[model samples]
Target: MTSAGSTGWNVVQLADIPATPWRNGGGVTRELAMWPDAGDWAWRMSVADVDKSGPFSKFDGIDRWFTVLEGAGVQLDVAGVLHRVTAGDAPLFFDGAADTGCELIDGKTRDFNLMVRRGSQPSKMVRVEGRHSETLNAMKTIAVYAHHSPARVLFDEEVLQLAHATLAWRMVTGSAAVGIAAQGALWMEIPA
Candidate 1:
């Protein structure tokens, strides 16, 4: 249900954005926050708020994708499914409609969170570590983080340079591209 185009791609550094408090139904807290745009559905980078203890309450009406950014491991209690996630694994997607909470399995954990419209906009948070081609339809926004070498980001026929940390790109509907880099992570946001 989005009509945005592919010309919105722009790169940004993750460290450049200030961390903000994570707000949910009961106003939960997180460590960091970043996104391509502060639109209705916001993609985020969140480190755990270990300082705060939580068997915290859950939330609804949002779609969430969780990807590990650092630390040992993390697990989520969704509805009744206990999903244990580690680094370098595929991201976990669940409905925010469930009564979900998090527990740090070992040490603290850092992760990326994508909150989008339940049905109007469906999205995925992928951890891109090598060369791959992504065919993205609908309105798409990509956030790439360079963990090792500088990242080469391609959008349609254009290319942009990205440094270690985090960067974002906006692509129009029906556009796709391939990315090449030594090491890093890429999260693509799409309509649900």
Candidate 2:
């Protein structure tokens, strides 16, 4: 966050959010944000701690994206097919309504999750390391989350320093050039 241009931001440290137990009893979750700020949000984001192997809650007509933020990894079962996901891997995208289950690779895992209701909210996310520089436009939100390492962003001549396990997002108003330096971080964009 910075007083730059027409956009404003909210920077959140994940540790500050209260953890809510998952209905499956497999773990807990700390919800980060939801679009519309009201009932029936189009998109949702959160950090989930998977402590054991179990089934995942279903969400019909929703697209799910998952990325490992900490710990070893997990094998996600989607419709009987197994996909191994780790911190170094790209986010896995699958149908939220699919028969999904998780098996831990070793111990518990901390993960980043984004669920977008089909047709209501479209999004794209990428795991970033090193450096990234680009011009972004026509977006409702642009967010960066530093998972296990600190990161930095430069926007509108303003610099935002993101500590470990911090999520910083801005209400994107117009096109702007952004520069980011991070390791094992998640970068996301949601169209306006």
Candidate 3:
């Protein structure tokens, strides 16, 4: 099952959110992702600030997402059930094997995360600002994350480009129709 725009995704840069002591009590910087399909089915990205504290552990074939890039509260706790997230809303799923924690409220914050596994399938995160079109199947893969200014993805003719926080392509087959010539902000993934 690999027709209608056959697979493509590139634009990953991470590894810069480390100092310890809760990121020196302020100014937390992150990226540390870009697995590029290798081994234990991995994919990770990070960005966090504002009263930062963390307790993230659990990966039995991962599957998770938490997005809040800016400010307006943030709180997450899986296995105990507690979620209060803001900043563009909608993208809070759990069960990455359970047991996770985080709590933040006030100013200074940025967030984006994706952990994929569970037998190399089942993955979805959405937040696209402009032009759109969809349809992909076959081992599945689609990931596009950019926020305003710098966009262009047309699967079925082959064209992958992105800017403004670039988290470009990742498609694994057939049916295309995703356009964004202006208004940015995006995140798309399919892996079931």
Ordered by lDDT, highest first, the candidates read 2, 3, 1
**Candidate 1 stretches greater than 4 Å from native:** 1-7, 21-53, 147-149
TM-score: which candidate is best? 2
Candidate 1 per-residue lDDT over residues 84-155, each given as its tens digit: 887777888887678776777777666666655566556766777777566665565555555545777776
Number of residue pairs clashing in candidate 3, backbone atoms closer than 3 angstroms, sequence gap of 3 or more or interchain: 12
Quality of model 3 by C-alpha lDDT: 0.62
Model-by-model lDDT, in order?
A: 0.59, 0.85, 0.62
- TM accuracy, model 1: 0.74
TM-score of 2: 0.91
Q: Please report the candidate that would top lDDT against the real structure.
A: 2
Once fitted onto the true fold, the runs of candidate 3 whose alpha carbons sit more than 4 angstroms away are 1-62, 72-95, 105-117, 120-138, 148-150, 156-171, 174-189
Model 3 residue 102 distance off true place after TM-score fit, in angstroms: 1.7
Tell me model 1's lDDT, rounded to 2 decimals: 0.59
TM-score of each: 0.74, 0.91, 0.32
Ten contiguous residues with the weakest lDDT in model 1: 25-34
- Report how far off residue 181 is in candidate 1 (Å): 2.6
lDDT of 1 at 25: 28
Model 3, 1-192: lDDT tens digits are 111233445565323235233534544545444455335445665554545656765678577787786677678788888898876677887778898777776655677777766554567786666676665545556666665467777767667765566665554655555555536565657564
